[model samples]
Target: MTRKQLDTDIVIAGGGLAGATLALALTRAIPALRITVVEAFPLTPDASADTYQPSYDARSTALAWGSRLMFEELDLWGALARHATPIRHIHVSDRGRFGATRLAASDHDQDALGYVVDNRWLGLCLMSALVACPQVTWRAPAQVRGVTNNVRGVAVQVASGEHVTELQAQCVVIADGGRSGLREQLGFRVDSSSYGQHALIANVSTSCDHGFTAYERFTDAGPMALLPHGSGDRAGHDSALVWTLTDDALERILAVTDEERCQQLQQRFGWRLGRFTRIGQCHHYPLTLTTVNEVVRPGIALIGNAAHTLHPVAGQGFNLALRGIMALVEQLQQAQVRGEHLGSLQILRHYQENHRRDCQSTVRFSDSLIQIFGLDIPAMKLARDAGLVGLDLLPGAKRWFARSAMGLGGRRPRFGAVTQEVMDD
Candidate 1:
């Protein structure tokens, strides 16, 4: 295929949070490059970013402070911050144990350790931004049937309605998600380990205010987190819950009445935020630790959940994906400046090399939290208590923990700003 035969410079699979954000980053970094985003779900027609109203049971994501900075670079923080709830403090404790640790934003010299925003709102902001960029083309209610590497680049087969269209691009980015069929279609080897646990997610209101503090509690059963949710007057009164449970426990919980479920939750979480007065719609997801043997090929790259999926105990999934996005953009910018092929293996390798350490450390951090806390041996339990107490008493260790939770554990990558010329266009 020749230049004239190529449909776009880049093709992004799955226009969810990761895919959509990558599209915006690429357009801002390379003003002249043409890109196409293929998504399986149809977007809400005529959705206005300014008018988005989240539902009472809206799902939420925890954005690390570092992730906030990346959005600011993309000129999206202003819009996102409007609905975001700042986490001024984090309270972590082992259920029915004496081990506990507290982290404050003041100690880190920041306004917030992180922010919790509804996932729907975040998607709205990203989609709105993508629409304003002339260099991007979106294909929704469509599926990428297959992708194969060609001499000139990669050939992408996208199906919409009854029609199937084949498009060629310099690179294909697979951000379809953790269970990405596209990644497997390309023959990427994946290693997966089941935790034999499932997460029960829901939104709940408390009799007492949360004071903008997020809570993480560990029990013999599994780990549970309650993140501050909503904004303004509703902020302190409500929280988004992620409760980990065994298969049998999950079934029992789901079978109970709302009031009974709240009572069980209060039993596990204690009275930190008082009684769980109300519970919203509940969702369940199995816990798994998954990673791919290779994230990049000659003309392809894997990102977001497609590349790695972690235990939700630490809430590091999306934040880690954001860092990977920026790293890839940095390498692509360099490749563009050098007039090299965007899909060149050399360029893609550099991207992976820079991000490998961060990925490995994050995976270890999340998995370790689960393994260490999951142990029922008395000796291990004593050790865990000591470790938590020690972490609180040691300033250096506490600082490191704070940084890691804020997604600043590794070297930060620089993202290109949108040029004035492109802005004018």
Candidate 2:
């Protein structure tokens, strides 16, 4: 029996946010190109559907200013606006210490520093935009069974239903996730290390209004953040909580009831939010740092978590990946202009080279922050506290931090043709 062969210019494995966003960007950038996205879980363009897939679930994401610009460029921001809550200010401090710093959007001359949007809403927006593109062929509920690289390009074996279809593409992008089987099949070496922490996440109602402010409080156990998530079903004001804890702590926390967990959270986070009245369902994710030493090969590339996974402390994971996607889109556009093969080693190499520095630097920055703050030495603690206080006092230092946190540092891709108000170097 012979399998049906489908051909496209590019085949993207994984139709999650990253894959969907890339498909939209590429279709807009190169309208003539043929693209196919294979996702294991089914996705619907209908925003009303409630099928409960992991990718389009209750998890929330923080979209940095730069990420917002990218979505704006793609014309997907308006769809997400109603569901998103702007983060006008950020309050960072060390629990039980005098170290603290505040970041205000007004001080940076920006309307908002970032936004918090539920993943379900974002998935709907991205899928809706993707459906509008006639150049894309979305294959949901399809799994990549195998991949073979040939002289011309790569051939992917996809299993959908009872049929195995062969997809031939000039380039194949692996955006499935950190544990992508395709990534390993493609022979990319991955360096994975555990952070000895687990993130306990949930949405909760606070006694006091969040006022569009996000808080990051570092504690002896780990870091905890409460990002404003607007009003939800059971609340007047709500915030999404990401509390990192030790494995033992996580076990203990998970063993208790929701009310008990809320009490524990209140004890750790303090009276800043007044009190945690209620908490919704809780989820846990083990913290780990995963990196692919080599991101590109002859006819393949990896994006999003498939490329790297960072600690959730800084909320830089998705934003950094967005920047990398933008850079890759730019390189792909340039390659097309030059009549270069999209899957050629040269084109893939160019994309990798452009993002390598930014990836390394961002990962290092987040890891360094975690290590420095987690130090037990009194001197190091004093130095870190002084650094935070210094940031609060020094306007120059604060501005630099805001710029970097907004994803505007280093070589930023032109999000749009029109001039955007951004910080000057």
Candidate 3:
């Protein structure tokens, strides 16, 4: 296949958060690029914001400060901020322990440490932006069955219902998710280890207000977090919960009555928010640490959970993926300027190299937290308690910890608009 015979410049194999965000970022940075996104589910670009109803059990993602900046560059933050709740303070403590530490946004001279937005609203915003871009095409209710690399580009086999079609693109991005079969189909080596834990997620109302504070409590069972949710009068009263529990514990928690479940939660979580008065529908997800041996190959790349899935102990999964998206976009923009094939190994290698350290550091950070806190040794417990206490007295160490959590500890990618001078070339 020749360049002229290619159907699109890129064929994205999943249209979830990672795929949609990549499409928007690429089109925004390189306006003339033609892209097609293949998603298995239906997308509603025409979703009405005015008629939108917030779900009490809606899933949410914590967008780090750096992620917010990237969205601002992409011009999606304005719409996102409407439904986002600011996490002005974070209270970290060990249940039944003597030490604790708190981080305040005001201390760091920032508006908020982070923002939590429902996944529904975030998807709507991305879909709206994608609908307005003429260079991008959506192939929903469709799946990429296979990808074949040729000397010139890549051939993508897509299936929708009874019809199957093969399209050609210079590059194919696999963002289907952590459980992506395509990655395995293409023979990518993956290393996966289960944490022997499940995260029980739900939205709960408290007897006392959250005061815009997020809580991270380490318990003998596992790590649990409560992120503030809702707005106006509902703001401080509601929170999204992620409680990590072992398989046996998870089974018991799910079998219990709602009242009993709430009581169990109160015991593990203590009375930071007084009491858990109401609980929404509960969902459970097994925790795992999965990493790909190579995130890039000739004519192919993986992003989002497809690239790496971390333990939710730190909520770094999506934020890390967002950073990877921007880095890939920056490299693709540079490749276009140089008139190189989008899937050339040279270009893909640069993307991987530039993003390697960040990926490793983040994965290590998240995994280490679980390893450290999951320990029940008496000496380990005493040391961790002292460390937490010392973290407050040591300003530099505390700032570093806070920055790491905010996703601002490393080389930040620049996703600014490509100059007209470069585009004209």
lDDT, each prediction = 0.91, 0.84, 0.90
* Winning candidate number (lDDT): 1
Candidate 1: give the clashing pairs: none
Candidate 3 per-residue lDDT over residues 139-258, each given as its tens digit = 989999999988778899999998999998999999999999999899899999999999999999999999888999999999999999987234578999999999999999999999
Off by over 4 Å in 2: 1-6, 45-57, 231-236, 415-425
**Candidate 1 per-residue C-alpha lDDT over 238-330 given as tens digits, one digit per residue, 9 for 90 to 100:** 999999999999999999999999999999998989889999999999999999867999999999999999999999999999999999998
Candidates 1 and 3 compared: the better one by lDDT is 1
Return the lDDT, model 2, position 83: 73
Clashes of each: 0, 0, 0
User: Judged by lDDT against the true structure, how good is candidate 2?
Assistant: 0.84
Tens-place lDDT per residue, model 2, 1-425, is 01133378889999998998899889877788889999999865455523433331267999999889888888888877767778888998988889899999999889889988888778877877777788899888998877888866888899899999997888888899888998887678999999999998888888898988889998888899999886422223688899999999999999999889989998899999898988888899899999987899888899999999999999999999888888888777776666677888888888899999999999998898889889888898898899999999999999888887787777876433322222110
Runs of candidate 1 exceeding 4 Å displacement: 232-235, 417-425
